[model samples]
Target chain A: MACGRPKLRVGPSQREGGFTDSVPATVSRMENQSMRITALIVCLPLCAFGAATAQGLLLQRAGSQAENRPVIPKASKGDQCVADTEIMRKDHMSLLNHQRDETVIEGIRSEPYSLVSCVNCHAQTDTSGQAIRIDAEGQFCESCHSYAAVKIDCFTCHAAKPAAMEVIGNAEPHLMRDNPHTLVSYLLNKEANE
Target chain B: MSRVPVADNEKSLQARRRFLQGLGLAGMASMSYSLLEVKAKTPASSDKRWGLLIETEKCSSGCDACVRGCNEEHGIDDAGDDLTRAQWIRKIDLKDELTGNETSLPVMCQHCESAPCVDVCPTGASFKRADGVVLVNKHTCIGCRYCMMACPYKARSFIHETLTEQKPSAPRGKGTVESCTLCVHRIDEEQDRQPACAVKCTEEAHSAITFGDLNDPDSSISQKLNTLGGSQIRADLQLNTGVRYQGL
Candidate 1:
C-alpha cells in the first residue's frame, strides 16, 4: 500500500507528535519500512552488473585495442607542479653512446625522445642565442614541481646541475658496468651473497 | 621465472624466397605472398589476443633499441633540449649494490589497458591511438604536467617555453611527460615501415626491440612473447601495460 509503506527518510523527530508515549509504535513502523528499503538496495548491484556487462562489450569493440594496454591513472592538478625535466652529465651521454657515432638526433627529440624532453623544456637560451641547459634549480621544472607537490629522485643519479657548454668528446673509454644481464641474474646475484 | 622463447625464423624465411630473375613488382608481390603464405601455414599459437615473446636472455643491458626505435619512427624532433622539457621511452638501468654491476633494461610507457595517465589528464590530451600506441594529444595539452607525475614509467614530455621555432607535439613539447609511442603513427600510415628501434638494432648484439600487436596471436610481438616468458613491470600497479619485459 502506497508503494512499500512510504519512504523512511531520516529527519529530526516529529516535534508536534506527542510521541513521548507512543515510542513502541514508532519503532515498529520504522523497522518494517527499513526492511523494504534493504530489499530494494540488494537488487541494485545485480541489475547494474548486467547493464555494465553489455555496455562493456560495446566499449571494448569501439576501443578494440583497449584490453592489453596499460592502466595509468590520471594525476590530480597537484602534479602540474612536478618538475618536467632532469639534468644529466655529458659523461652519462657518452657512456651510453656505446655505438660511438654521436649526434644522431641533433637534439633530444631524435633517438631518446623521453630523455630529450628534458632538454626541450629545460635548455635555456643565452643573450647570444646559444641554447644551454638551464640551472635545474631555476628551471621551469623546479617552478611547478615546487608548486604541485612531490619530489622525484631523477635528479640524484642524473645531474641536476648545468652541463658544460660544449660536449666533451669521448676522450676516455668506458668500462662496462657489472649490472645483471637478466632478471634471473639480478635475483641470483642479489640473493646469492646474502 | 621461465626464460622467454626466441623468435627464430631466418632459415624458413630464407628458404621461402624464390629467385625470379626477371620478376617485376607484380612478381615480387606474388613472391611476397608466398613468403607470407609460408608463415601463415606454420602452426601458430591459438591463444592470439595477448601473447608476447620476449627473450630476456638476449636483452643486452647494453642495447636500447626499443627506446630509440619509438622516438625515431614517431618523428619527435625536439632537438634544442632542456632536462625539464624532456621526453622519450626510457631504458631502465638496474645496478647491483654489492657487485657494482648495472643492468640496462629498456622501458617505456607500458600502455596499460587501464591507464592512469588517461584517467589523470585533466584536458583529456593523453589518449591511446586506435592501433595500440598510447599518446598524448599536444593540441589539447595545456602545458600542465600532471600526466608526467602520474606515469609510472615516466613516459611523457612537456614543452616548457615559447621558442621561435615551436615544434609540433609529435615528440611531445617542452613541458609534457614524453614516453614511447610504440610507433602508432608509423604503424598506421606506413604499410611496411616497422618501429625505428627494431629496424636499427643489430640482431647479433641484442634484438631487444620487439614490435607487433600482442593481441594478434600471429603478430611477431605476440608469438615471441607467447613462446617466451614475459612479466609486466610494477605489476602491483594493476596496469596491464602493452609492453612487457622478458626474463625478469
Candidate 2:
C-alpha cells in the first residue's frame, strides 16, 4: 500500500549488466510492475506491529503523569495499549496450566487424615474454625466403587485422592501454611524412629 | 515480480546450481533436492526394515532417569522453550478399571509408519526413516507448527525461544520442531548403543521402557506389549503409532 507512484513502461537499458540476452520478452512487457505483491506478503504483519508499538508509546505518555495513582488508560487491542486478544488468551491459558502443575508438583499426600503432618492433600474446614477433615471426593476412588456396592479398597494401601487442591475454595486450614513437621533434624529423627 | 523467459530461467537455475556447487554444497538423490542443494543431510535408505515396540506397563513415571539419561546420552536437551532442545519424554496419567486409580508412565513420539506430521508439513522438514522411525531436521524447519496440528498424540511443540546452555550430546538450535528420535542419532551413528532412556531405568523399579524388533516374538518389547495387552493412544487415526500405552 506504500506504493503510490505510477508504473514505468520501459525496461532497463541493454547496458545494464543485471539484464542481458537472458532477459525475457515478458519481463519487458511487465516493466511497470513494482515489487508490491512480494513485499506486501512480508510487510503487512510488520506494519501491524509498528502500529501496536506506536499505540503503546501514546498510552505510556499519558500514564506517566499520575503518581501513587491507579492508571487505567482507555485503549483498544488494535490501538496496541494492550496485547491482542489472541496473545492474551494464550498467555492466560499457559498461566492457568502452570498453576495446575505447581499445585500437584508435591505429588501425593502421605499421611492419614488424622495427622496434620501432610498438607498437600488433606486440609481443615473453616466453619469448624479448627484443623478438621476435608471433603475431597475423587471420581476414580468414589464413583464406581460405590455403584458396585463395594467398599473402597483404597484405605487398605492408599488414602483417598486429593480433591481440587488447586482450586482456592472456602476451607480455612487449607488456606493456612502451618506445618506439623517443623525442623529438618526433627523430621530426620521422626523418620529414623518410624 | 519480473517474469523471466524460459531460457533465462533455465540459465538462472544453472547459475544457481553452479553457485551452490562453488559454495561446496551437495544435494540428495532426488531432483528437487534443489532446495537442499548444499546440505545433503538426511540418509536416503538403509536396505533394512527396523522397528520398535514399547511396553507401557513396564514404565514408571517417577523415574525420570530414562528422560534425563536419554537427554544426556543423545546430546538432546532435556528441557527447553524451543523445539530444537525439546526432547521431552512425558509421563502421562490415566484412570484404571481394576484399581480405580491414577496410573502414570512415560510417553514419547510414536514414530508412526503413516506419519501425519510428514503428511502435513508444507516444507519437507519432517521425514521418515527407511526403517520405521520418524525424525525432523532443525535447520530446514520454518517453525510453522503445521506438524503439531497433524500429530494425533499432541506430541509436538513449536519451540518459540532458545535456552542459555547447549547440550553436547544432542545438539539443538532455536525455533524449530523436535520430538523423540528413539535415540536415532545413537542407533544410526554409534555401533549398537542402547537408547539413553532405556539404559537409565533401574531394573528393580520397572525395567527399562524396553524397545526392540516388533516383528520378532522373542523380542522383549514385543513380548511385553503383546502379552500385557498394552494399547496405543488415539488409535482411531490409524497412523498405527509405534508407541503403545498400558495403564489406560
**Predictions in order: chain A TM-score:** 0.27, 0.20
lDDT tens readout by residue for model 2, A1-194: 76788886665664466456676666654443455566787899999999999999988876873432322222211122122445433443342232222111211122111111222223333465442222233232233234445574223211222222322132233222322222232334456667
- Model 2 Cα lDDT, one tens digit per residue, B1-248: 11223234335434643554443222123223222223223332334334444455566556576777756554455544544446557766667778787667777778886787877667656766545567665535788889888787767755555433332224344567778777764454333445667666743456646666665677766777778766777777766667765656
Q: How far does residue A193 in candidate 2 sit from its true spot (Å)?
A: 62
True contacts kept of each: 0.00, 0.00
Instruction: Tell me which residue pairs clash in candidate 2.
Output: B75-B169, B75-B170, B76-B170, B82-B159, B83-B159
Show model 1 residue runs off by greater than 4 Å.
A1-194, B1-54, B64-82, B97-102, B163-177, B202-205
Model 2 chain B: ten consecutive residues of lowest lDDT: B30-39
In terms of lDDT, the poorest run of 10 residues in model 1 chain A is A99-108
Model 2 misplaced stretches (Cα beyond 4 Å): A1-194, B1-52, B74-87, B97-99, B163-165, B202-205, B216-218, B225-229
Best by TM-score: 2
Candidate 1 chain B weakest lDDT stretch, 10 residues: B1-10
**How does model 2 score on DockQ?**
0.01
Model 1: per-residue Cα lDDT over A39-61, one tens digit each: 88998898999999999998988
